[model samples]
Target: MVIEENECILLQHRTDEDNWCIPGGVMEIGETFEETVKRETFEETGLEVNGLELFGIYSGESCFVQ
Candidate 1:
């Protein structure tokens, strides 16, 4: 879910966690799954309601988030 804006890809810098993810995080309890994707993108990269286009959905048990 990387947002290609200008020249740089939108990445998150979490002070308490990983510093570079494509603006996403864990789902809050009872919240919609898409809510996690949308909300996390905003909270991390500070972009909201722009031109978000879905490229793909990723799933795995390994790698960075694992």
Candidate 2:
């Protein structure tokens, strides 16, 4: 999830589910990890990304969230 310049987290309203969620989707073929995030973010929020930094990577997670 990304925090916008206005201090608001970029969230998309899914029409099917009507739930708030950060811009995210499955990565496409031959795309780098950073490219995936950037692509997904823009696709969902219509925001052009300048850069992104990875804080951590979780593997084999058993629901780190909820």
Q: What is the lDDT of every predicted structure here? A: 0.67, 0.73
Q: lDDT winner among the candidates? A: 2
| C-alpha-based local distance difference test score of model 2 | 0.73
TM-score of each: 0.54, 0.70
In candidate 2, stretches whose alpha carbon ends up further than 4 angstroms from where it belongs are 58-66
Q: How much is the lDDT of residue 6 in candidate 1?
A: 72
Q: Candidate 1's error at 63, in angstroms?
A: 9.2
**Residue lDDT tens for model 2, 3-65:** 476676667899889898777776677998788888888888788786587765444566343
* lDDT (10s digit) by residue, model 1, range 1-66: 577757977666667865666666666779866677778777766767455566766566653352
**Over 4 Å off, model 1:** 28-34, 60-66
| lDDT, model 1 | 0.67
The 10-residue segment of model 1 with minimum total lDDT is 57-66
